[model samples]
Target chain A: MWMIDLRGIIPAATVVGCILLIWTLAVIPMNAHLAADMAARGDVVVTPHSPQDRKAMTGVTIAVKNPVIIAMTYSLDRPRLPSPHQVAVEMHNTIFTVAPTSRRSLVHHAWVTLSATLLGFVIGTTLGVLLAVGIVYNRTMDKSVMPWAITSQTIPILALAPMIIVMLGAIGIQGLLPKSIISAYLSFFPVVVGMVKGLRSPDAMQLDLLRTYNANAPQGFWKLRLPASMPYLFTSLKIGISAALVGAIVGELPTGARAGFGARMLVGDQYGQPMVTWAALFGAAITAALLVGLISFIERRTLNRMGMGAA
Target chain B: MTPATITARNLDLTFETNDGPVHALKDVSLDINKGDFVSFIGPSGCGKTTFLRCIAGLEQPTSGDISVNGMTPDAARMARAYGYVFQAAGLYPWRTIGGNIRLPLEIMGFSKAEMADRVAHVMDLVDLNGFEKKFPWQLSGGMQQRASIARALAFDADILLMDEPFGALDEIVRDHLNEQLLKLWARTEKTIGFVTHSIPEAVYLSTKIVVMSPRPGRITDIIESPLPRDRPLNIRDSAEFINIAHRVRDGLRSGHVDD
Candidate 1:
C-alpha cells in the first residue's frame, strides 16, 4: 500500500518538498537568531593591547563592525556546534585571504593530514596483513603476539603520546615519523583481525578440493585464500584509514609542533582564538572522509575486477 | 613401474569424535585392475566415501596399507595417479566452467596453449562446449558435476574416483549422465572407483560391486556383474540387468541385516 502510494511523480515530489520545508523551518530561524547575536560580540585582542588602551578599544570596535569577525568569534565561544554559515565563512576567509601558503589555511592543513594518512595507511595495512598471516599460520606466534597487541591498545594513546614524542626526539626521529607511528598503531589491529578471519573463510569442502589437487601451502594461499580475503581486507582498510587520521591528529598533540591541524588547535586554545581551532577541526574531518572515500572507491574497483562485487 | 594397479590390504579407519570412537571402515581389501570399473555400495557412513578418500590420499588407513599404482597413495598423488569427484560437485565458484576444467592441467604445468586445447577437448567430451565462459553458479547441478568430471579428465589421469557423483540428481538426469559416463569410460578406458547407495546404479555401472555394512564398517560381499561391457540405458530394463540389480539388492539387505 505504501509503495503504491509513492508511485506517482507528484507524490514523490511532494514528499521531498515536505522534507526540505521541515529542514528549513527547523534550521533557518535558529541560524538567523544566532547570526544576529554574533553581530553584537567583538573579536578578542590576542596581542594584549600593545601598552595602549585606546588602540585595544579601536580593535574591538572594528571587530564588532566586521560581520565575518563577529561570526568567527561567536563560533569560538560556542565550539560544541557551529552553524554551517559560520564555518563556511571562516573557511573562505582563512583559506583565501590570510596567508594562502600557511598551514593555518584549511587547504594547506588538509594536504598535511592527507599525506600522513595515506602513508600511514599503506604501512599499517602491510604490517597488519603480515601479522595476520603469522597469527593464522603459526600457533606459537598467535599465542604470543595476539595478547601483546590486545594489551597495547588498553594503554590509552593520550597518555602514550608524550612518551612517543620524547622517545622519537631522543632518537632524532622527528615530525612525521612519530605521527605516522601513532597512525600505524591505531590502524593495524582491525586489519589483522579482519584478514585472519577472511583468510580462513573457505568452506571445508573447498579445502578438500584443494587437497585433492595436491596443492601446497603457497599454492593454496595464492589460488584460494588470498582471493577470498580481498573483500574483508578492503573493509578493514577503510576502518584503518579513518583511525590513522585520528592517530595523525593525536600525534601532533604532544610534539608541540608548529605545523599540522592539531598544533593549530593548541595554538588557538592558548590564545582563545576559536575560529582558527574550528577551522582546523573541519579540515581534519574533511581529510578523513576523503581518505575513506578514496579507499572505498579502490575497494569497489578491485572487488569488481575480482568478481566479488556487490550483487 | 606400470604400477600393480591399486591394492588395498585390509584397510581399517576409525574416527575419535565427541561421541567416542566411531569405526568408519574395517578390514576391507580390494584390488582395482587396470581399466576396470568398481563400485562400492552401502548405507550411509558404511565407509564407501571413506574408502574413496583413502584411495585419494585424503585419509590414511588406521591399520592397513593402500598402494596406488605401486606407491603409497600420497606418493602416487604427487605422480597424479588419480582424479577425484566428490558427492556434490566441488567446482570453484569464482572460476569459469572452462577455468574449472583447466585447474588440474594448470597444476601439472600444462602450457597455456595446451591447457586451452585440453579444456576444449574435455568440454566437448562432457557436452559443455558453449558454457565454457560461464561460472559454475550459472549452471544446473548436473551440468556443474559434468564440468567437475571434465576437470578430473583434463589431466588424463588413469584412475577416476567418484563418490556418488550423480546421487543428487533426478532419475532422468542421472540416467542421461550415466549413459554419457559409460561412453566416456569406454572411450578413454580409465579405471574408475565409484561409490553409490543405489542398487540399480551399482548394477548398471560396475564390473564389480563391493557391498558394505555399517557400525564397524566392513565389506560383506563382492558381486561381479554378468552384463556385457557394451550396454545402454534400456539395458536396465533387461533380464540380465534385473538379475544383477536383484543380486546387489540382496547383497545390500543381507549386509544391513547381518549386523
Candidate 2:
C-alpha cells in the first residue's frame, strides 16, 4: 500500500491551483502599463498615444480601454510583474538548456545554495542536539543555557548575517563557511527547542522503568530518550532545513557571492530582469520543498520501522 | 520456608507541599517473601503505589526502614533486583514487541545471543510469540500490557512489582489477564508485588493481601488467602473466595472509618 493517499493530493493541489488563478489574474493589471506603451508604439488606437501618459492612468483603465493590449501584458520582456508562464520558460531554459556546471544554469545556482543548506543543517542539528542534551541532563545548563538559546533566536538573522559574514571574512574564512555559519545559526534554534522537548518526552513511569533495571544514564538515553526523540527530531529537521535554505539564500544576497540562488536574485534585480529573479525565487522554493520532502520521507520510514509511526 | 524478599518497618513519607506536609505514607510496614504473590490494595492516595515505588527505590521515605533482598531499596534497585510494571503498559512506541521485551536484557549488557534467546522466551511466555516485529500500537491494550510484563520478566530479576497493570482494561480483558498473570506467577515463581484498588483482583492473585487506606496512608489488615495454589476462574464465585473478599472489604471499611 502506498503511504500517502492519492486523495490527500487534492487539498494541497487545489490550494496551489487557486493561488495560480489569483496570480494569473493579477498579472494583467500589473503589466498593463508596459502593454499600453507597446500598444501605442504599434499605433493600435489608444486613448493616450504618449507612453508617459499611460503610467498616470490606472492599469485597469488602460486594460479596459485597449482590450487588444491585454494579451500584450502577458508577454512583456521585463514587465513590472513577469507572467507565470514567462518565469516557467525562464526556469526551464536556465535549468535545462545549459550544462549543470554553467554559472547561468538555475540548477547550478540551486546546488550551490543547497550545499550550504545541507552542510549548515547537519551542523546545526548536531549542535542543537548536544545543547538539548546538556539542557536536559544538567540543571545548571538548563537554567543558564536555555535562556541564552531563547535570547539568541530573538536577534533577527538578517541583522546578524552581515556581521557574521564580515567577521568570518576578516578572519580569512570566506565563501561557504560564512554562509554555512549563517545557515547553521538560523537552523539551530528550532532543533534545540524541538529536541529538548523530544528528549524529555519520556514520562516519569517510563524513566522509572529504566531505573528499575538499574539502567545508567547512557542506557536510559539510548534505550528510551533517544528513540523517543525521533519524531521530534524529524519535525525540527523539516523546520531547520527550510530555515537553512533561507539562510543560505540570504547569505548569498549581501555578500556578493558569485554562484548561488541569492546572488542570481540580486544580479537579476540589479539588471532589471524580473524573469531571472523570479526563476531564482522559484528555484529556491523548489529546493526547500524537496529538502523538506526528503526529511518527511525518511521520517516515515524510520518511525514506521521503529514502531513510532502513529506518534 | 520462603525467605523474606522485601521488608518494611515504620515507613513514613511526607511531602512538604505548599498546602502543608502531605503524609503520603505513615507508619506503613509489610513483609513479602520469596515466591509469594502479594497485593497492595487501597483507595487513592493510600501510598500503595508509593510503598511499591519505595521498594523499587523510585521514592524516598523520610523516616522509614525498607529493604529489598537484605539490601537498601536504592541498593537493590541499582543491583537490578526487581522489575516494575506501571499503571499503564508504558511500552516504548518506537520498539517492536520483541524489542520492548528485550530492553532490560539489553540494558544489563547480555550477550546478543542471550538477548535474542530471552526475548524469544519471554515473548512466548506472554503469548506474544508471533508479534516479535509488531509495533506497540499494532497490539491491543491487553497485548501491550502483556508485552510490558514480558519486558519486566526478560532479565533474571526475581521480584516483579506491578502497579495496577490491568486497571485500564474492561472486565473481560482484565479477567483474562488476571488468569494469565496467576499462571505466569506460578510458572516463574518470582516474588510479585502487585498494587490494585480492586478487591477481587487483590483476592484472586495474591498469596497475601495487604489492605490499606488513605488520609496519611497506613496498613489496616494483612490477610493470607486460604485459597489453594491451583485456582480456576470459577474459584472467585466459591464461598471460600467470597469469605476472604468480604473480610478484605471489612478491613477497607474499618480503615476508612479510622480516618
Candidate 3:
C-alpha cells in the first residue's frame, strides 16, 4: 500500500513541481518592467548599481546575469504575475495569521463559499436524482427531459451567472441563496446523467428475476435500482462537488460580494494585487481537491461495504 | 393423478424488434405435473427458455392459454407460486447469500424471524448452510448458482422454473450440481421446469424430457423417463439411462431435421 501510494504521489508531485518552477521562472520576466520602474522611483533599491547599469542589460541576459533584478521581481508589491512564494505567503497570512472570523482572512471567505457550495450540492443532488428516477421510469421524461437537461448545460455559466443573480436579487433574494442556486444549476447535470445510467445498469436477467418475485416499481427501485445506482451516484457526486465549488466561486464574481473567494479575487483585481487573487484561487483549488477526496473516501468505504470492492 | 402444476396449450410468443417480428415460440404445449422434474432440451434459440419464462410469467404468450396451479400465469406470479432462476445465477453482487435468499421473503412481507428460518432451510437444502455470509463474487460459479436456487426456494414456492441454470459450469461441477439439484427436487417436491441442452442431464434428472427445435421454436417430442425417483450418481452408467439418453438424442436430431 505504501509503495502504491508513493507511486501515485511521485507523478503528482512532479507535475506540481514543474508548474511551480515554470510560474517562478516566468514571473521574473513578466514583472521586469515594473521592477525596473520601482528601482527608478527609489521606493525599492534592488541593487547598489545605478539604474543606467540595469538599463544597459537587455531581456534574457538581464534576467540571467542580474540576480538583484530577479530578486526584485519576486518581492514586488503590485506584480503582473505573482511569484509562487508570494502567493503562498499571502495565502498563509490570510488563512492563518488572522482570526478565522475576520473578513480579510481566506479561511473566513472559504467558509462563506463552502456553505453555499454544500447547500447547492444537496439541492442539486436531490433534483438530479429525482429527474433521473423520473427519466428511467417514464418514457416521456426520458425522451423530453433528457434532451433539455443536455441542452441546459450548453449555455455558458458565465453568461447565465449575472442574469440569475440579478433576477434573484430583483425578488429581494441575495447573497448565499443566489450563489447556491447557481451551484445547484451547475452540479445537477452530472448527477442526472450518472444516475440515469446507473439506475438502468441492471441487465434484463436481473430485471426478470425481480419480475418473477412480482416486485413492484417502488420495491425494484429501493432494492435493485437504488443500490445499483450507488457507485455511479458517488462518482457523479465527486464531479458535482467540484462543479459546485466552481459555481460558488463564479456566483461570487457577478454579485460584487463582500465575502468568499470570488469576492477576494475581485478585490485583488481592482486593487492590482495579483498575490491576493492567486492566493484565493489556490484556496478554491485546495477546497475542491479536499471535497473530491472526502467523497472518494466515502465512496471507497460504502462500495467496499456493499461488496463492490473499491469500485 | 397429480394435478397439472403448469399447463400451456398452443402457446406462441413473437418478439417485435426493429428489424422484424422474431418468432421465439410457436405452438409450444406442455403439462407439468405437481412434484415433477421436467427438463426441456434443445439447441440455442430453441425457445425452451421462452417456454420456462412463460411458465414463470416472465414472458407473455402472444396467443393461446397458459396456466400455473389452475390460475393464469400472471395471477400465479402475483401469488408468488413460482420462483424463476435465470441462465446466469443473477445473484445481486451487493447482497450476501443470506440477503439474496431473504429478498423474495422480504418482498412477500414475511416476518423477520420467518424470513431467517426460511433462508436457513433453503440454504441447508442447497448444501450452502455456512456460506450464508459470503457474497456471490466470493463463491465459486456453481456455489453462486446454488445460492440463486436457495434464493428461489426461500419463499417456498410450489414451482421452480430454471432456465439453463448450470449451462455455464464445467462438466465436473455440472454433474455434481445436477446430482445436488435432483436431491433438492426430491426433498422439496416442488414442480420444476428446467431448460437444458444436454441429453444425459435431461435423462438423469427429469421425470419428463422435452426435445425442442428452433427457427420458430416448437416441441418435437416429450419423453416420459422410466428412471426411478431415487437416482444415484452411478445411475448414469446404467443401460436404462443410456437408452433414455439415446432416445433424447434421437429426438433432438429429428428436431434439427424438421427445422
lDDT of 2 by residue, B1-259 (tens): 7668999999999989999999999998888989889999989998899899999999999997999999999999999999888889998887788888888888888999999999988888888889999888899999999999999888868999999999999999999999999998888999999999999999999899999999888999999999998889999999999999999999989888756
Q: After superposition, which runs of candidate 2 have C-alpha atoms over 4 Å from their true positions?
A: A1-4, A50-53, B1-3
- DockQ: the better of candidates 1 and 2: 2
> Which candidate wins on lDDT?
2
Comparing 1 and 2 by TM-score, which wins?
A: 2
Candidate 2 CAPRI category: high
Per-residue CA lDDT of model 3 for B29-50, tens digit only, reads: 8888998999999899889888
Question: For every model shown, what is its TM-score relative to the native structure?
Answer: 0.84, 0.96, 0.95
lDDT of 2 by residue, A103-194 (tens): 88998998899999889988998999999999999999999998998899899888989999999899899988889988998899999999
Q: Write down the worst ten-residue block by lDDT for model 2 chain A.
A: A302-311
* TM-score, predicted candidate 3 vs. hidden true structure: 0.95
**How many clashes in each candidate?**
0, 0, 0
Q: Pull out the clashing pairs in model 3.
A: none
Question: Could you tell me the fnat of model 1?
Answer: 0.34
Q: Pick the candidate with the highest TM-score.
A: 2
Candidates ranked by TM-score: 2, 3, 1
